[model samples]
Target chain A: MKRILAADIGGTTCKLGVFTPDLELLDKWEIPTDTTDEGSRILEDIHQSFKSKGDDHELNLAGVIGIGLGVPGPVDFNNGILNGAINLNWMEQKPIVSEFESISGIRTIVDNDANVAALGEQFKGAGSGHKDVVMVTLGTGVGGGVVSNSMLIHGHGGAAGEIGHLYVDYNRRFQCNCGKKGCLETVASATGMKNLAVHYYESGMTDTLLKNGIEAGTLSAKSIVEAGEKDDALALKVIDEVAHYIAVALSSLSAVTNPKYFILGGGVSRAGRMLTDRIEAYYRPITFPPAYENTEIVMAELGNDAGIYGAARLVKQFLA
Target chain B: MKRILAADIGGTTCKLGVFTPDLELLDKWEIPTDTTDEGSRILEDIHQSFKSKGDDHELNLAGVIGIGLGVPGPVDFNNGILNGAINLNWMEQKPIVSEFESISGIRTIVDNDANVAALGEQFKGAGSGHKDVVMVTLGTGVGGGVVSNSMLIHGHGGAAGEIGHLYVDYNRRFQCNCGKKGCLETVASATGMKNLAVHYYESGMTDTLLKNGIEAGTLSAKSIVEAGEKDDALALKVIDEVAHYIAVALSSLSAVTNPKYFILGGGVSRAGRMLTDRIEAYYRPITFPPAYENTEIVMAELGNDAGIYGAARLVKQFLA
Candidate 1:
């Protein structure tokens, strides 16, 4: 009765899941992430939580086949190194695979969180039936993961799917935290939408309900999306502007990876069809014809569970 | 002692190569492409030429393992379909694999010319020893091919490497043949360079050796590169502009595939260090940090023979 363990390690919490050898989820739980002491205690905390769970459930560690981890930064997949996760307060290359494997006496694999989330979607979410898929996660920052030939592409530096950093804002409207001006993340992420709203407000077009939020610097993507749903002009304009940049990024992605599905995930994507429809409108007229005609823009279905599922799927793929 | 044959099917001529199972080139030749009658006789002519070559060289058709083709158009690799090669007058889907196999009594594989060329470079040219590579072909038209994880990525609709179509010109300066405005191809291809020279001349910046040629529509990418070599201001300006757009496209490619080597090829690449150096300069500050730091821009070594080598590489991969 061998089992698999998956952990989606985030800044504040770690989501854990237990799966059978065949990848059926048996159990799932969460534990607060410890970020103090250079995040050195995080791995031990995860290991101890699994141990406690095992004891409570009469689960034996020896029966675990492997552990798969989704980390919150770029990963050297082959080497199993998590490279500099600032939010996790781990700014150095951590030997994730070796540490986890040694701690649990099981084989372990690690990949970037966004990449694993994409793998999760490709396996069971919106991209389930597609071999080629691009998952764009528009959360705090826009993130991307590309799957080609049914395998995640890590690129030469494990940076193959940094679609958020793609150059899109031609006017250099906002500077991305990635030290680049006019990145896709500057206008398409949750923060990017708010930035767009502020930009619109500053441009003397302040005739909207979002004006108070924009002026107070308290505008949220969720609020803007909610307003847009109610036919608010500024909110719709902001959504359209964000969708345009995203569409530009997707069009460029089409010319590069040309995936069958562009799965939109993250907080920003919760706007649903309103965002997707506008993105499709902007995407179709500009993307490479073959790709534009074939690729679909769909909402991600996995939500918060994508990372855990993707981690489990990584183990499944490894077993295969 | 089995052999593999590769054919690079272009509009004017088809370059053919014979190779051992080890992929060492044994012989190479060329035949004029008969693009008349909607390219109906193209496959048959290739088979006949191969037959003649085999007869003259004491080669037996049965000893050949397979034939690989590189066609100058979008290719449905799995179905062996050429979706529409306007230059070859192939306006409809042509069953290239079935037609070639039936005509020559050999197994066959077909891929896009730009894609195969990238595979060729990845196998033996500047990208040798690199699993992740991208090849940008700056010929009459800009073409691209991406190889990730040491394999060519044809995308869902076999349009993965259409880097030429990436939206780059923020000004929407020129209309692309792909029915899009502001495509990278409109500003980076050989003809694109000529168009830029014309645009510059029309805008009253005409104090160079290219003025008469631009006015007469006889301006060539070669003249521009040579003039740039001699520090001609107008030619340098055009080269810089082309490099800028190409760099923008490559930066976006970094966010997608993030290959280790960007192999520059086709006729315009012969401008050598003058072009690649400028492209690297523009690319470094803009692409994703990891990709920008790790990826190297290099010149294509195989030149005209890249297509044939790449075509043969396709068969080798198939056999594997």
Candidate 2:
């Protein structure tokens, strides 16, 4: 009758889940993430909310086995510390594990948000049944999580799965936030897609809805993708270009880890087949032959719930 | 005391070693690889050599716990099968582990040569004391092995760590044996270096000892790297270009699985500090910042013996 608690902390919101030891979500909710005082109050806020939730559910807090946190930053998993979360305004190392454990009196595990999402997908979503998975999350920016042999590959400095920063566009046409030109993020992230659309439109290939979106100051990755789905020329071109860059990154990733499944997640991934089809087409001819023959491109199935599921699963895995 | 047997099976020679369970090498030797008849006799030949070595050294073959084989191809590790090895004319699936086990009456474990070599380096060479390591072997061709969290990452199809095939040189200038254009192997291998020398020379940059070597058919990756050490113009340029591509590949690798150390081995690595220093210089400016700061590029310490050491380590790890 043991229970588990999980949290996926992001820039704006924190998703919380209460689950049975078997990982069945009993209840889930969200709360605003307060960035005041550099997120110093975040852990206390989370603890209060969990306490209230347990009370409301008539749940015994003592039955909770542990809590897992998916934070928006690199994590020193061994120490359960957030390296730095710029998005959360926690720009210095935060001892999340010890603080959370002390407040909740429960064991805690912490990992990068993207990595946990990948674990979630691998455990019960797109990557279900696959031991090796690469999940690329295309939200405001691009992020990735690599699972090899069913374990997250936290690189030397917890920078293992930064797929977005993979150098892809050798022409260096676009600059990434990471101070690198030609990164996959420069062309495939949501903003990167918008930028590509603008680049294409300004380069005299302007016969599309993106032009309207641009002049109206309504240009966004979603609109561009919708236009592309509707066969808008410039938007489709941008999709093609984005898919190409994504495929390039996947090809390189294949050569490196050769995961069985490359799961596309986040808002942009809702493009689904429209994006996966293009990626597979471009990926087939370019990726390492063995990887091409063995690996599959899939869509994320858990949607927004992936983070919470991943977080809970992290606790389950750690306990196991 | 329990003992272990290890073999590194290559195209020309098979290096064999005997080690105590403590991994202390008791003896080592080599024999010509009988690659005749599609390599059908390979297991018997290895067994014969091991038996002879045991007799000569008064070794108790009965005390050997297991034998580990490092083969020159993709492996189905779970099945203990060589998927295929073209260099040894092993073009079809071969159940190496079972066959060797049957021949030698010793349990067997098998892995790709590059993978075991990486494990070797990680266990006791340049990667000693590091849990995550990436080893790049710049031999006649470029090969790589990636170890993460103290385990080799053998992707879905055992095609993980195929770093030589990483897509580089967006220009698609050179063709790789894998039928790809602009792979890391197309520019960073020993032959790749020679080809770069040829490309540079043909493009009218011919003002070095490389020209004389080229004219004399003595142009080698070694000669070019050595000449680069003495500041030969064309040779230095080729070295710079090779180092650039290697750095680019490393940067991408760092973004993927930022290992603690990049162990450079094989003949091309014999260029020593001249090659590593340039690689580091170029690598520092391009790699993911965390990786650049945390990962160190070092020369392989085990050299030709790495394969045998790695092979033995494989048995050790498998038994553990």
| Interface RMSD score of candidate 1 | 1.0
Tens digit of lDDT per residue, candidate 1, span A79-132? Answer: 999888998899988888998888778789999999999999988899988899
Q: Give the Cα lDDT of each candidate.
A: 0.87, 0.87
DockQ category of candidate 2: medium
Candidate 1 lDDT at B167 equals: 85
- lDDT tens readout by residue for model 1, B1-320: 58888999988999988888888998898899888888889889888888888865456787888889999888999899998898889998889898888888899999999999999999888998889999999988899899998899988888898988988886778888889887888899898998898888888888888877887888899999988888888899999999888999989988888889898888888888888888988888777688777888888899879999999998989953
TM-score of each: 0.94, 0.94
Clashing pairs in 2: none
What CAPRI grade goes to candidate 1?
medium
Q: Candidate 1: deviation at residue A186, Å?
A: 1.2
List ranges where model 1 is wrong by over 4 Å.
A51-63, A227-233, B51-62, B227-233
> Candidate 2, which segments miss by more than 4 Å at Cα?
A55-59, A206-208, A215-217, B55-62, B206-208, B212-218, B226-232
TM-score of chain A of 1: 0.95
